[model samples]
Each structure stands twice: as C-alpha cells, then as structure tokens.
Target chain A: MSATIHRLDNRPQPSLEPMVQLVAQDMNLVNAVILDRMQSEIPLIPELAGHLIAGGGKRMRPMLTLASAKLLGYPGNRHHRLAAAVEFIHTATLLHDDVVDGSDLRRGKRTANLIWGNPASVLVGDFLFSRSFELMVEDGSLKVLKILSSASAIIAEGEVNQLTAARRLDIGEQRYLDIIGAKTAALFAAACRIAAVVAERPEAEEAALDAYGRNLGIAFQLVDDAIDYVSDADTMGKDAGDDFREGKMTLPVILAFARGSEEDRRFWQAAIHGHRTSDADFAQAVSLIRGARAVEDTLARARHYGQRAIDALGLFAGGKAKDAMIEAVEFAIGRAY
Target chain B: MSATIHRLDNRPQPSLEPMVQLVAQDMNLVNAVILDRMQSEIPLIPELAGHLIAGGGKRMRPMLTLASAKLLGYPGNRHHRLAAAVEFIHTATLLHDDVVDGSDLRRGKRTANLIWGNPASVLVGDFLFSRSFELMVEDGSLKVLKILSSASAIIAEGEVNQLTAARRLDIGEQRYLDIIGAKTAALFAAACRIAAVVAERPEAEEAALDAYGRNLGIAFQLVDDAIDYVSDADTMGKDAGDDFREGKMTLPVILAFARGSEEDRRFWQAAIHGHRTSDADFAQAVSLIRGARAVEDTLARARHYGQRAIDALGLFAGGKAKDAMIEAVEFAIGRAY
Candidate 1:
C-alpha cells in the first residue's frame, strides 16, 4: 500500500551513485521544510492538501528549488520557504489538472477529484494558489513574485493549448514542445531560477539552472509518453493506454500513426476520431507502435534531453548539490521505476 | 450600439456636477492602464481580455481604489496602477463567474461563453488573474499583494460555498451575507485598503477605507438582488427572476419563504426543492414576494448599509473624493431604471 515502495527488481541501474547519495541527504531537509510550510495554513487546506502531498509524489519541483539554492551558495533559510512555495503551486495545479482531465488516479492513489467533488477540488486548488502567492509576498522579493506569477500565467496558457489540442492528430512537434514547456517546464525552470534569484547568483549561473530544469522537465514528460503503453497499471498508477483510450495524441502514438499504412490510418481514425476503440483496437495500436519502434525512439529523445540537462549544470561549480541535480535529470528520464 | 452607452443612460442619475467629472477622470486613467497591462505573449489572451475590458461594465472597484487613495492624500500616480489592477481582478472574476454560472447574457451582449466557448473564457480569465498579480508585484508592496491574494482566496471560497448552497432554500440571512461578502465584498474591501497602503496612509485611515468598501459592496449586492426580480432584461442585461429560476436563495426569497403560510411553503417546496418550477410558479412566487413586501424590506436593508458606508468615511477629512464616494454609495442602493 506504500506508494513510494517501487518494485526495484525491474528498475534500471543508475550510474550516478555519488549523486544519488547527495540527493537523498538533501531530500531529508527539503521534505521537512515542505511539511512545515504546508501546515502554516488552516486545517481545512492542509487536510485536503495532505491527501495529495502524502500520496508519494516525487517532490521533484521542490528538490530543484532547494538544490539550485544550495548550488548558488545561499546562506539564508528562505530557500526552504521558496521550495515549499514551489511545491504548493505545483500541487495546486495537479489538483486542478486532475479535475480538468477527469483523471481517476494519480501517484498510484485515488485523485483528489475522485475523493472530493470537482467543485471542492477546484476551490481548494485556488486556496493553495493564493496561499502560495501570500507566502512569496511575505518574502518581500518582487523579482521572485514576478517570475512565479508569469510562470503561473504560462502554465494556464499551456493547459488551454492542451485542451484545444486533445485528439488533434495534426498537432506538430514544436507546438507539443511549447505546450509541455509551459505546462511542466515553466514551473520547473521558475522554481530553480527563483532559488538562484534568492541566493543572488550570477546571471549566467541562474540561466544555466533554469535551462537544466527546463530540459529535465521535457525529458521527464518524454519518458512518461514512452511508458504509456508499456508500463503496467501498478507502476504507472493508471490503466495502460489510457491516453489512447481518451484519444489523446502522445508522441509515440503520433509517430506510430504517421508510419502506419492506409488501413492503419483508417483504424486510427475509427479509434481516435470516431471514439469507437475497443480492447482489440488497443492491441492493434500497440502492435503498430512496436512495429515502428516509436517507444524506443521516444526514449532515445528523452535520454538526449536528459544528457543535455546534466550538461547545462556544468556552468555551476561542481558540488554535492550539482551532483544531486545531475542524478535528478537522469532519474527523470528512465532510471526511476 | 455600445453596451456602455446604453447601460450608463439607465443608471441612477446623481447631480452630475463633481462626482461625474471625478469618476470619468479616474476611469480614463484606469482604463488606459488596463488596456496596457492586458497584453500577453498569447495573442488570443489580449484579444479576449480586450473584449471583456471594453464591454462597458461600471468600473466601480477601480473607482473605490482611486477614491480611497485620493482621500488618503496620495501624491503619486501609483494609485492609478493599483486601481487598474483592482478593475482587472474584478473583470477576470466576472469572466469566470459567468462561465461557472452558465450565464448567456451580460450587459445585453452574449456572454464570453456564447462568443468564444467556456474554455477560452475560463483560460483567459486565469490569464487576467495572473496578470493582476504581476501588476501588483510591479508596485513593490508586499502588504498590498498579501491583501489582494487573501481577498482572491476568500472570493474563490465564497464561490464554492455558493455552488454548494445552490437550490437549497434553507440558507439563512447571516449565511447569505457571509457568502456575498466573500464573493463580492472581500475584493472590494481589499481594493480600497490596498490603495491606502500604497499611499502609506495611517492605519486608522486604511481600516476606514476597508470598512467603507465592504459596506458599499454589501449594499451593491443587495440592490443587485432586488433588481434581478423586478427589472426586465432590457434594463438589467439579464433575465428577470434569474436567481429564482436558478433556485438561488437570496435575501427577499429567504425572508418571504420564512413568513409564508403553510400553503405558500408547499408552493415553494414544489417549485424550489422539487425543481418543478414553471412560468406559473414564477408568477406565484413574484406575487407572494410583492404581497410580503420582501423586496421593499430588502431595499431598506441596502439603504442602511449605504448609510453605514457613508459613516465609515467620517475618519477621512472631507474632500471631493469623499463626496463622490458618498454619492456612489447612495447611487448603489437607489433605483437604476
């Protein structure tokens, strides 16, 4: 029943042993601060938030916040507050995203929407968002507020783009990157950059941390798409091929569909456009994806980005924080089971 | 053909000597700032925002912001930015409110949902909300941000409360006031108080402006409920008795139902609780409301709040801004047809 207990027998062996140890150490401090800041609001908010926060999420956003601040040589404890703020914003968006996507499961647990009604989830999400802004204002840093606010706007716009792009097979790679960057990477980048801003890091170092976060987010999303059909429900926290069932056009599916024959095109049109897909349809789609090696291709792209994320962090001087960040990028792509 | 021109003509007329000039001058500056701040990276965002911003609703929130600042003897133009920020937040909420309420008409024009679809309106409203925070961050005042963010949180909570209370006629007057205060008055109060904060006024003056805005907002909502039952679509820009049709429990209906006879209670139970209301049910409800003089009694309460709003201004020294604010309170509760 423990969501964080992964079945490690089938997991990939990570090469960054030293980095993993450093991240494990930093994560202890980050987790404590997150728990403390999450408790500052009223009981109702934390009660609702606890359902998701304690549900075994990776806490990657907050980790980036804390790690980037440490890498930038932050002497103050405000980075912990900023880290908590980052996680709160990300968590709030997840709560709303589940409602909008009508998702039933998240992080291997029943989503907030499945437990509470959509209205409650939405209002609670709003509460978390406002509370995050209130926390940031308390820091009295206009630069941090501006960066976070703009990132929030970008995230909302990305969701809108995804809404319009759902089931649209014609959506191109550039548009997909834009959408994912806004929805996922913008927050990741903002979280890391804000930590650097708080630490008063050099401009080049701040930009490098931002780039690292962005690339890591993109690579993470790529792996998510690659695992859609291959990962089991127990591992992925949802039914296999749910995106295909919902007519969502992910990268692997798009690539597979593009390489399919005319008959295959008809099959996709029947499933995606007509919304008449069955288990047999899912089987056939999986077969076509395997035949085209779309999943393999997608994973390759994810690895490339993962490497780029690690390379970006080279701008900062090597340290435990930098090593942990590098390990995070690798884990995001495919190391995590 | 302009929505503003028609709506302004039907609004209650004051002496049109000093208040009119002041409102116009304040609104002109506020409107320009609003137009400037609404621009975004996404083209459709600014376009959708422009449609709503130029849609001709009364800029009451911004006016309060400006008046509060002027009364505090603000010598700089930062108040104009704050006033515009207030209006943007209000407009953004309205955009989302119409979608949440499933409304089809606003200011005698089609709702944003009717024009661009619910997704666009909802997302654009979010953009505006985020933009408002960005503008406030530019002002470099953490106190103002805290007040506005808290106001926004309360507003969202109020909306959720209203959604849960819908079609439930058992809601009492105090509960209704709490709901309306959260939904309407919180932002208004924050807007006024923030102006004083920006002006660096004394604490006593800031509290008074907050109280004044709060009372005025409550009075405005009370008058709005009265208009909903009595005014036609042509004048009110919405269907008459819309609240009743939606099974919302407002002040007059709550009071009337409480005083109704057994037979009258049965009628209400069937129409509201049973959800079997028709034109005949509406007519009967209207007649019962008239018979009980519930609308008149509600108007009396609104006028009381209007007077309280004027009294709150006693903390400030008398000036043109103070006079306009007092007159604005009177106009809020007075007839608008």
Candidate 2:
C-alpha cells in the first residue's frame, strides 16, 4: 500500500497533463467519434453542439475511461466509442444545466443557452442524449448500456433533488453529499466502471475503478464549489460566486451557516433567499466564509475524497497508468488553489 | 383487401375507444410500470411527472404497441414493460416540448412547465427518458434498444429541425412531412415495431407494423394541425390557433401560403412572422384559411395517410385487433371534422 501511494507534494505542482498524455492517442479516437456523431443534417445541431464540443473542455470523464482501460491493459477500441458516449452525456447535462441554472458563462465563454436561447439548448441537449444512447446501443453491450442508462437516471434524479433543495438553509452536509453523489459522482463511477466492463475484468476490479471515479467526482465538485469562493473568472474559467448568485447550496455555504454567529447567519439567510446579490455582497459573503473557515473545511473535505479516490486505485498494479490516475485526482483537488 | 377495408363513413362516429379497449388490460400493466419506474427518493420527480403522465393523454403510442402485439398474436407480457418505456419516452419529450414551445395548456390542463417551472420540467423529462432506457435494458433486448434509441435521436433531430423552421413562411410540404415523420411518427413506428420484435416476428411483419404506426402518426398530426383551425379548446382539448400564436408552421400554413393569392400571402407572411397575433388576427387567419380550403385539404391529406395506415395492416388477418387498429386511424383523421 505504501509503495502504491503517490504523494502529490513530491512534485512542485499536480496537473491533468499526465492523464491527458496517457490517453492522448485514445483521446484522438474519442474526439473523432464525438465530432462525427454530433453531426446532424440540421445546421444548428452541429453549429450549437460544436460551439461547446469544440469549446476548450478538458474531456475529464472520457479521459478517465481511456486511462482506466490502459491501466487494465485492455486491448480493444470499444472504450473509445464508449468514452464519446460519456462525453455526450456530460455535454447534454451541461446544456440542460445551463438552462436550469440560467448560466450565462461556462468555461470562460457564453453558454449555449445564452447564445441560442433555452429552447434550442433544451432540444439539442435531448438530441445529444438520444445520440449517446444510440452510441451505446450500437456498441450492443447490455451491461454497459444498463450502467450508463442507470447512471443517467440517477444523475437526473440528483439534479431534481438539488433543484428542490435550492435556497434552503436547512440542507445539511449528509443531504448535500447525497445530492452530489448522485448528480456528479454517478457518471464518474460509471465512466470508470465501463472501462472495467469493456476490459472484461472481474467484478472486484470494476468495483475498485467505480470507487475511484466516484470519490474523485465528489472531490472534483467540492473543489469547484470552493473555488467559486476563492477564485475569480479569469483563472477559474467559471466566475467566482456564480453559484452564490444563483443561490446554489454548496458545502461552503452550509458549513458557514451552521458555524456562523447570529449576525452572520442572518447575512447568509438573506444571501440564500435572494436578497443579497451584488459584488459587494459576494465580497462580504466570502469574508464571512473565510472567517468561518468554510472554504478551508471544504478543501479539507475534498482532500478526504481525493485520498479515498487515490486509495481506490491501489489494488491495480503500479505503473504510469496508476500514477496518472492518482495525479488526475490531485489535479481535481488542486484546482481550487 | 376488400374484406379488411373499414371506411370511416360506416359508423356515425369514429372513436379511439375500440383501440383503447383492445389494449385496456395490457395498458393496466403498462401503467403500473410507468407509475413504479417514475418514482424516486426525490418527491418532485413523482409529483411533477405525475402531473403530466396522469394528465388526460390518450396513451396513443403505447396503445399502438399493445394492439400491434395483439395483431401479431404474440402471447407475451414483455410488451407491457416496453410499452411503458415507450410512454416514458413520449412523456419525457412532452415535458421538454412544453419547455421548448412554452406551451401553456395540454389536454385542457395547464402544462407541468406552467405549474412547476421549466427547470423542473427539463430535469424530470430527462429522468423519465433515462428510466425508459433502464426499463428497456432490464428487458435485455438489443434490437428493441436500437429501434427506440434511434427513434429518440430522430425525434430530437426533428424537434431541432422544426425549431429552425418555425415562423418561416418559406418551409414547404415535403420538409414538414420530414419533420413530423421524425418528431411524431418515428416514435410511433418504433412503438409498433418493438412489439413485433418482442413477439419474435419476422422482419417483414416488423416493417409492416412500423409502416402501420408511421402512417397513423402522420395522419394523427395532420388532423391535429387541421383541428387547430377548425375547433375550439372545449372540443379539441388544446386551444385553437395556439400554434398560430406561437408562429408554428404546419401543413395548413404551408398549403395556405402555397395556394393563397398575393394579398393573402402577405397576411400569412405577417401572421407567421409575429406581426399578427390576437383574437382578431386569428379570426382573420381562420377566415383566410377557410377561404383557401386549407383545413379541408389538410383533412384530405390525413385521410390519405389514414388509408395508407389501414392498408399497411391489410397483411394481417382480419379480426378484432385489426379492426381496432384500423379504426384508430379513422379516429385520428375523423377528429378534424
């Protein structure tokens, strides 16, 4: 276990480059499938989808698929198509999410919903989702299909759960975990699990990768939430306090509210319920969060999940694949700083 | 062929009752699957989904699946779950459609989007869609998966296609057929075709059922478009000119534009482009449509498809199932009058 442990502090900086480099050749195939399958006779389908697909996303989920496959020594191209399907599912969710959140900017650019309006965004998202299923069906693996379709349902359920929990100060850490678990981690888990499946590995191996992806996903989301309070638009790509502006409940806010004094709690209540919104309000909110050490604790939580994620890959043999996978977790956690 | 022919005029009124009765017992099982699968830990999922699912939809697509199964003399319970899956897909599309169209009323009730907001509608629609695939995956039929998944993609493509075509006075009849054939008829075809696959029927029979459902769906849409001009909300269960107000292009408008005099063409161009939208404008539009005989010609087109739908069933043996299926087509077209 000690031998498999790859410490992040041993290096000056942790990066996603290792995973991206490990899967570089495979990533090309996945990208091709994404570009090819996203095409439709309708000009807008390709034009709008291309805006995001061609947009500078890290392809994190699909990269996980390729790297996991490489780690297992899986010698097949099935994961390439499957990886594209994962990205499509992710893209579809992003499209709907932008509409749901009414987000104007994503990854430092205007959202598809912002450019095309919500109606086109919704329809095209539906298209990509259906296309993802079609890709799965073409792969013709019931096991893979079941995993993805179930993950998709869980993600949607989680989204609806989060939607219902919005602006409510009473939502606790456990409920928040449940929401992110379903919404963010489910796909991450499925993305890695399918690699095991396509590799025809044992159930134990599949479970290990699933654990790896899931914990990493939770860490990934936690760090994103934390970064919103700590960083601004240029560095983060997503604007800081965008979640606060949308009144999204995250770990930082929940912890701050729970740990705040009477006046601080009143400020949070106003902020969550929509009374507090401007840059000054966000600045104050950040100060309150810092005072409560909410962001620090949030980063601590991300470290917990990131460690679990790293530990999950321990059972696999030590190699470049494992190092990249472990470092990917680090990069996810490292993003907030 | 002569013995199988059942004309609409043979009865005082054609109704959806016979087909509904033919599939009544089977629909009960399908309904159970729908209710059971739509549930989640999140309360809003069920509450919001139930608002639309239990709303007064006629269950047309699933009923076609059941009746087509009966027509094939397939003795199996598999179609019930699959039928529910089909319904789930339809419901998901309706939820998204409401958001896309900003529709206020459906089946004489306020839309779920109107009640719950667009975000909830979008998320719940995605949930239902994923649940539909999960049900199909549980059934473990790759062929059915291919058909439904493909159809879902086509439906979404059609929707996007229609979005681009909206309010454009230049869109003609062929493109409209292509659009409806996708958005409406593809699901209808897949719904009927999957029953044959579950029944283990040959390709010819599957194609026959597909043809039957496709034509019926086209006829259904034509009649629906025509009724929007000829009937009121009390009878039609949807507000007349709602499409017109929204600047939707249907066969009626295309034909009206194609056949109208220059003066009339200018009115339609203005109406479609948003210069005309009021009770008075709709009344004037209705008069112009009547003067151009667009509604009459639209119903004529519906009957043409209805005849094709009936003829597609001619390959099957004449019996209660066939009669009900044929009558369903008649009921579809007869709604216009």
Candidate 3:
C-alpha cells in the first residue's frame, strides 16, 4: 500500500513532457484496440458503427476506462474490451439522443440523422447498444455485467427525467443534479469503476475509483453546461446556446431564471415556454446570465467538483494513470475551448 | 419426469370452458401484480407508465411468462416478478417503437406519441426498459438477467434489421424470418425460456420448452403478419395494410412480389417501393397475394410452426398448463380471423 501510494502521488503529469511522450506512444495502441473491438461479426453493424466510430469524436470515456484500469495495476489486456464497450454505449446513446432531440448538427458535422434519416440512426443506435452488451458478455464477469447493466439503466432513466424536465422552468438544482448524474456521471463512474472491478482491486480501492469517476463526470457535465452559452459552434462542434434554444433547463439558466425579476421571468417564459426564441432573446438571456454572474457561479461549482474528483484520486496510490486522470479532470473543466 | 410430461400435455386451453373460467378467475390477480410492479418510486413515471399499461393491452407477454412458469410445475411466486418484468419490457419496446415509427395509433387508441409527444414517449419508454432490468435484478438470478438482457439486445437488433429490410423488395424469406424472429419472436421465446430456467427444470425439459417457445413465437408473429393483411383496422387495432402503407416488407407481400409477373412487380414497385398506392393498387395487391396463394402459403407456414410448437410439448407430461400452451398455439393460428 505504501509503495502504491508513493507511485501514485509521485507520478508525473501526463500532459507534461515526459509523460506526454508516454501517452503519445500508447495512443496508437488504444486507438487500434478501439477500432478492432468496434468491428462486429455482423457486417451491417460494423459498417454502421464504423461510420460513427471513425467520425473523429474524442474518445474521452474509453481513455478514462483504459487509464483507470492501468492505474489499478491491471495485468490483463481486457481493459481494452471494457473501454470499447464504454465508447460503444456512449456512441449508441448519442445516436438515439440526437434523433430524439431532432438535432441535425454534431461534432461540427451533419449528424447520422441528417445523413441517413432518423429511423436509420435509431436502428443503428440499437445495433450498437446490442453489440455493446455482446462485448460485455464476452468479458464473462457477472460483476461487470451487473455494473454495466445497472449504469445503462440509470443513464436511460436520467435521460428520461431530463426529457420530462425539459421546458419546465421550475426544475430545481437537485433535479438537475439527479438528471445529469444519471445521464452523464453514471456511465463515467461505471466506466472507471468497472475497470477497477475488472482489475480485481480491493473494495475500498474500487469505491475510491468510483468516486473519482463520479465527481469527474459531474465536473465534466457542469463544464459542458457552462460552455453551452459561451463556446462557438465551430469550437464546441454543436450550436452555441443550443440548450437554451431547446429550452433545456441547465444549471446556470435555471439559477438565473430563479433569481430573475418579474420582467425577466416573463421574457424567459415567452422565450422558453412559448417555444420561440430569436437571436435577440439569446443575447438578452446571455446578458442576464452575465449580469447575474451565473456563468462564474457555475464554473465555480464545476471547479469544486473537479477538485473533489482530484481529491478522490488521492484515496488511491499515485501513478501515471492517476496523474492522467487528474489532468483529464482539469482538461474537462478548462480545455474545451 | 412422468409428472412433468403429464403437466405439459394435460394443460387446458384458455378457450375451453374450464380454462376460460380459470383465466377469468386469475385475470384480476395477474392484473394486480402487473399494476403493482409498474409503479415507480418516481411519481411521474408511474403516471406515465399507467397511461400505457391501463390503456388496455392484452398483457400477453406476462400471461406467457406466468403460464410457462406454472406449466413447469413452479410452486412459488417469483414467476409473478418475471411475468411483470416481461410485460414491462414489452410495453417499453412498444413505446419506443411507436416513437421510432412516428406512429399515432396503437391498440385502437391514440399512442403515447399523440398523448405525450415523441420526446416524452421516447424517454418514458427508456424508463420502462430500465425499470424492467431493475425488476429482473431483484429476482437475484444472473441467469434470468442474462436471458432478459440477451432478449432485449436481440429484439433491438431485430428492429434494426427490420428497418433495413423495409422497402427492400429483394429481402428474402430467410431474411424476413430473421427480422421477424428477432423483432417479435425472440422475446416471446425468452419469456418462456426464462420461466423454465426459473423453475430449474431438467436440462432436456428446459431445451424442449425453449424450442416450444421459439416455435410458438414464430407462429404468433406469422399470425400477426397474416392479420395485418386480412383483419379490419377496428379488429386489428391498426390500419388495414398499414405495413404496406409504411413500406414494411412483410412475408405475404414479399412472396407475392417475388412470384408476381413483371406487371405485378411494377404495381408493387409503384405501391410499395415508390410509395404510391391508390385503392385500386391496394385491392390489386391483395388480390395478387390471394391469387398467388401467398396468404395461404404464409398460413401453412404458421400452421407448421404451430404444430411444431405443440409437438415440442410432447417432451413434457400431460397437464393443465401443458394443454393450455398447446391450445394457445392453436388459438394463435386458428383464430387469425
């Protein structure tokens, strides 16, 4: 345990020169494993999946899975399998979510829905989801299955809650937290936690890893919400203020709306509940948010969660994997520009 | 073994006077359990779920689950949990399917889509899917989870295959069978097979029961397809030739189109492929199908599967439950009118 702690704490930051070289070297291996696992015995599946997997989105979830497993001193190569499963689940959900939301833009390109139609996108999403389970089953660990299945269920439930909560201006922070935790963090936590489980770590170590993942997930989502208002469409690879356009009740907007005057409430009601918003409304809302310092407040909360994520990693011994995870948390908060 | 054989063969048909009486007596109890299980700790979920469950579905999947368990000589009540889980899965799929298909009608009523909108319907469907998994996990059998999860994955895949097969007139019978089996029959087979697993039946008996279920599911889906062409919208609770309208490539149409003359193929291409169909086109297509004996051919296939389903029961002993299963298969094919 002493040696483990020393290794983890003394680990050099991967984003720094020496560790950066190490990650660069391993990146190709990880990418190859991801590509291999994404291939399906069913030709149609692999074709559809390849369309998305090769579509150039960041492999954030899989990176976390691989890093966490390595950090936990995994001797086996099965982390790559779990990592691919994580990405597949994420990709599948994105496909379905885009269709459900009727969004045409993703990653600064036309979504699958825009290219192939919603039905094709949806069915392909289902294909990926099923294929993911097949991959997980190949691992042949009941615990892994249980964790992944439970996380999948939670993720679905959260999405449902968010859908129900949409356009309801009264949505509180607690409900918002619950929704994002389920929709975003549940999978992120499960990705890392399951990696630890696969590595056969002690229960406490697993718990620490799970906490680290959960807080990181929270921070990531919070940062995402904060960036929604400010990031350019080209940079975010999605429409700026898209959440506002969709009447999605996010943290800053919800908080700002709660603190608004009667006139402000009427403005928001007309813009959101009325399902009509112009650039003027968007500008006004942005000004209102800035005036209220909601962005700063939200960013503060994100930083708090991000720090908590880093702190949780301290429960485990230090290593290159832990350092990478810590840097990933920081990157999630500030590097999305 | 002798008792098992007796139980299988001596099962009563629900159409029989005694069996009808028994079903009537137990319907309330089954309905109660289903309602109880459908309740979510989340308030909005139960209300949303109730909108569909109370909308008067026949509860066929749950009935199958309960019937299979009882037939297998299970004395305990865990089957109720599994039965409820089966119905939840079925209902969840329906909600999602309607959203995917943009369907406005189901079971002669306005669909959840019409009532709640697509986003709500989609999310609620997800909620039900997750809730079903939660219920299955509570039964504390990894085997049950494996069966249900696999069924879910297969069903989703089948849907994707069906979507791809849609409007592709070149799709063969084998492809059609695979699509339908995945989309509809897979869950049906799983429902009964899981029941057998729960009962901890002998390996040979379990395999026999699974075969019976698979064949029964095929027959059931075949009858459903047949009903789509022949039954009135009022009776079928869907539009007449709605599959054709939606450009779905069901069996009779596939068979008719495959064997039709060039002129007939042109008419199908115009109606199905080109998505242009007049009343004359509908009438001509129906007549061509009848002329080609495609419907009859499909019925023959259905009957063959139905008979196979009944014969599979020969492995089990004669009993009320077994008799009911055999009769159920007969009713599925015979009562297609």
Which is better, 2 or 3, measured by DockQ?
2
In order of lDDT, best first, we have 2, 1, 3
Can you give the lDDT of residue A335 in candidate 1? 45
Pick the DockQ winner. 2
Model 1: per-residue lDDT, tens digit, A1-337? 5432212112354444544354465667666766665562234556667899888877778777867877877778777667777887888789778766778988788888788666566666776677688778877788999999989888888877777777887876777788888989999899889988988878887788889888888888888877876886888787777788777777887788788888877777777774656877788888888888888888887877777787787677766777667666656665433
Candidates, DockQ? 0.45, 0.96, 0.41
The lDDT of each candidate is: 0.77, 0.93, 0.75
Which CAPRI category fits model 2?
high
lDDT score, candidate 3, position A77: 76
Cα RMSD (Å) between model 2 and the true structure? 1.2
lDDT of 3 by residue, B1-337 (tens): 2333222223333343333343453456666766886665456667777888998876767777777777777777777777777888888889878877778778888888788777667666666666676677667677777777778878877887777777888888999899888888888878888878888887777677777778878888887887777776788787777777778888898889888999888878877774666666677778899888888888888988877887887876667777777777766776564
Candidate 2 runs further than 4 Å off: A1-3, B1-4
Best by lDDT: 2
Query: Among these predicted structures, which one has the highest TM-score?
Result: 2
Tens digits of per-residue lDDT for model 1, B155-181: 877776776677777988988888889
- Supply candidate 2's per-residue lDDT for A3: 57
Weakest 10 consecutive residues of candidate 2 chain A by summed lDDT: A1-10
